[model samples]
Target chain A: MADETTPRLRIAVVGTGLIGGSILLRLHEAGNDVLGWDPQPAARAAAARRRVPFNDRLDVTLKGRDVVFLCGPLRALPESLTEVARLADDGCVITDVGSTKAEIADHAARLGLADRFIPGHPMAGTEKAGLDSAIGSLYDSAPWVLCPSSTDALPGFRLLTRLIIENFGARVVPMEPRAHDAVVALSSHIPHILAGALAGAAAGSAVKQAVLALAAGSFKDGTRVAGTPSSRTADMLISNRAAVVAQLDLVRAVLDGLVASLADADDAELLRRLQVGRGLREELLDRSMLPVTRSFDLARDDQAELDFLRRLGGDGGYVTGQETDATTVTYTALATR
Target chain B: MADETTPRLRIAVVGTGLIGGSILLRLHEAGNDVLGWDPQPAARAAAARRRVPFNDRLDVTLKGRDVVFLCGPLRALPESLTEVARLADDGCVITDVGSTKAEIADHAARLGLADRFIPGHPMAGTEKAGLDSAIGSLYDSAPWVLCPSSTDALPGFRLLTRLIIENFGARVVPMEPRAHDAVVALSSHIPHILAGALAGAAAGSAVKQAVLALAAGSFKDGTRVAGTPSSRTADMLISNRAAVVAQLDLVRAVLDGLVASLADADDAELLRRLQVGRGLREELLDRSMLPVTRSFDLARDDQAELDFLRRLGGDGGYVTGQETDATTVTYTALATR
Candidate 1:
């Protein structure tokens, strides 16, 4: 049984790849005992190099662990989850770093492990893969989403969330599995598709050479994600195929309006559409540059308010905030855990 | 009359804006005497602040000038060209830094100034505009294309090309007027349209707010050029409407193929297309990172070789190269002018 009083927890990291290795490296540094399991010998060797205990045997790795983090690629997650679910000790919480969460949640539910499986995804990645690219701070300042299978999993979800927040310094957001997939589909998955499609379109053109020469900041930025490995991008699209198709449908509808405007030679409508686009982009950039402050009417002595303050303190061991009033508070929404 | 031996040349720049102001600043620093004319008081005042001489009278600025550069917005170019032609001295070797060349070349031909007009475009710009955004090194290492009206104007073409090369440190490329328009439509014009359209499409979507929150590097890069002023982008597309439409058709065709592949649920085909895209992007990035070297076989004692050497020497006042043999020569394609 794990000790309840000590802050340090035992973390079993499955698939010692980029996300997994990063998790091991970070959790270990935070005074947690982390054991890793990867089928690949190279990955295990890499984990060993980082001084993270490695075992090819899933049964041995999950012994007395408080949490099991499945950080394998999209295709490997189901099998990895099945193995972890079968072997992990009772009361051990389960989570993952898969880009898609709906299918993983379904799989865990089918295995009668719904309460233990708190699906997760970190919205941070480079166009790199493998253990060599892993870094402890990969999740730093990035959104780390948690999608618990059911309300009954609240206790386990909170445990995993605290670990991610305190150890990884990641912003933990609670979201539904399907909603998470849909949101990411709109924000990230479709953008990746568009980037690749745009790059692909340029490649297949007769003026391909000239296009390459004239590509500036815009073209380079638009197509930056196209440099991601083909298998990785393909896997992401395939895993979330339904959500991706839905997002593509939305994009197609927008393009249809543009096509009609172009067909009619309606310069005014085209210009209007473009103007709206400029405004939206400006708003996004402005929001990112500007800090957002929120004012809430909360009694300082309230339990909920104190809980919020304690979580912030536990996140980085210390946090400072201003008290606006005896019965109200205003602060920047930092530590959105 | 301008002195042939001296590096200095008497130049007149119309519409003292970003492109024109940058040209004036760089050329003046290279010991050239430059005068400017702009209907906008603010533009002329900005030029004056930069110590670039300006006169409200077109006749005064154009007096005895060897070259007259038209650097106005797309909508203002025709009127600017007419006034420059009506006032500038004969054999002034009139040129422009307009994005589109065919229409301007046609306008100059109609005004009986075709023989002296050599249309040019520097394939470089920032999202920012006006004199404040002007920088002396705006054209450095940029592709400065020149489209002379006729071969009989070779002397004038060479002079303008040499000016762009030595004064601005630009790579001067000679192309036909229509060809320049068509190529730029493929390379720069259409990409700008896509950037704006992509951003516009996102804004028009139901998930606009979500997209704004979730936008990563790819979305931002793809939409960077969309932040450019609507009037400017609209002007560019309208000025080169036919070419822009043609390029749009090409893009639509590619999208059609992709949409069909997606509709069929052809994961393999979709992945194939994405793979091609990834490969193409890799090739582009690889080529950019690698330096290109070209070798030309020529006789060392040839007059053509000697003339090339002289131009290179006069360009920066010094030249160096490796000689292969007494009967053969090798040189870098530095001074294409």
Candidate 2:
């Protein structure tokens, strides 16, 4: 899609909610021929009001488009993709902005779109929803996880990664679908779940007012994501049930040890438990040590590049930029502890 | 004391660390005769450098002081109180700024300072320590918990409460020592522990770098307090051991239920748990409902006023201000759910 033959990219975002709207706004601002389509007339009207190119017909939205992004609710993804599969041209590489990736990746595989459809999750969100909530700079410096499993998808994956990096200013981290699900469960889902529980406990207490008043900082932050719409949060959690449940077990184990140390009045044990998370945070935040950057020069169609990309992402490395040749991608990763 | 015989206040802050220095700064800035003392020369020097009156002699600092605040480490508090007890005048009502109150209250009881010593806990802090971190506005709108047990301390307690409200701009909350510890164990200590554990789990992960990079907002806030000096956090948790242990059990139970719901794929139960914390946070944050305000006219020396004050604080009420007559106080409490 980004080849010299087609210098001007043709990009379409299906379902213009916050994520899609953001993508459409970004691609359009970057001077790409971007089109948006949402089955909901209200969403279409809103996008039209924002001066986004919203087409009523799926044929027009997908016609000769180089890339199309599915940003509908998880439940509607398969049908949305089915519609795109019937209408989209062969050159159109499909991608998605979804939280959990394994099931969708499987669905793409069954539909013979796995080679072209890259499951992506952008690490940017707010408590609010809808196209009106979308902003042009939503993905600025945000890590966007892209799972490219099929070797046949190498060329499309490379082009999409380049566009996401260049147009959206998103750092692209490529990993396995299952791995992405597991990592995000710990990083996002479990925290949101804990937030709800913590907030609920405080609200349920007899001293709710005092507790809430005292929660000016830590408590408020700890339970901050509990404010996210419950339905959306529930969807993300339930879909990644295995990974989130496993992470919850880990946190509970840590909490159990601290609780025991407290109950036993063991000062040494308690201090030890509390300090476990400290060193890593300090090291992560220490500015003296800069992240290590490495570059990979890949042949556009090489299957081996997928393995290299997976290893880089699995180890928490992200592609910083596509070099002048576009085949050479720069990867930046935290200095290993 | 606010007595007509010696209306101008004479206050002493007996430790020149952050809390002590902040108190000294506030009182000194309010045009009071505020004296400061600390065994550590560095602290005293810092206070002196800031033009806060730091007398080397404890007796001189305590001389004719109407209120002396013993602001020292939790372990050193008893010794600090003993020295204040030895040097402070009969008119001096002694108080200490400590996190937990049970053990210190017990020591005060045995030292015969219980009647005159009003145990206080100010709900304000920063991760950093030392007088260099002191800010004059630390308690501007913060809650200052006062555990006033004995009837003999009523007159002194009244004076200190009025001074804290009118001069320091703090809302005085009156409660029992045991109750204050219990409430804070839930409000402060438990959240700190959770923050440390959550931050630790992320930092300790195999994907630590990726997780930390993605932790721009919610995770950052959730684990913010885990950055507090390990020693101070440890001391607070250990001292409030029993209550923290109990609260941890409650959190663990909630987490366990959420985990089970996730594992069982119980969407209804998961949604229920997540929404538990949402409603309370929404209600607490909604400004349409103003707090209920009431007036309490106390006969300065009445023993029954202690019970009234206790009820107010236990229900999360705080003294907003002292009326011009000084015998009447304004109590502002959150409207009950």
Best by DockQ: 2
In model 2, how large is the Cα lDDT of residue B282? 86
> Chain A TM-score, candidate 1?
0.82
What DockQ does every candidate get?
0.30, 0.61
Recovered fraction of real interface contacts per model: 0.45, 0.58
TM-score of 2: 0.92
Which residue pairs collide in model 1, if any? A222-B222
User: What alpha-carbon RMSD in Å does predicted model 1 have with respect to the real structure?
Assistant: 7.2
Top model number, lDDT:
2
Candidate 2 residue-wise lDDT, B175-204, digit = tens: 888888877877788888888877778866
* Interface RMSD per candidate: 6.5, 1.7
Clashing pairs in 2: A200-B277, A277-B200
Name the regions of candidate 1 deviating beyond 4 angstroms.
A1-7, A48-57, A288-337, B1-7, B48-56, B288-337
- Where's the lowest-lDDT run of ten residues in candidate 2 chain A? A328-337
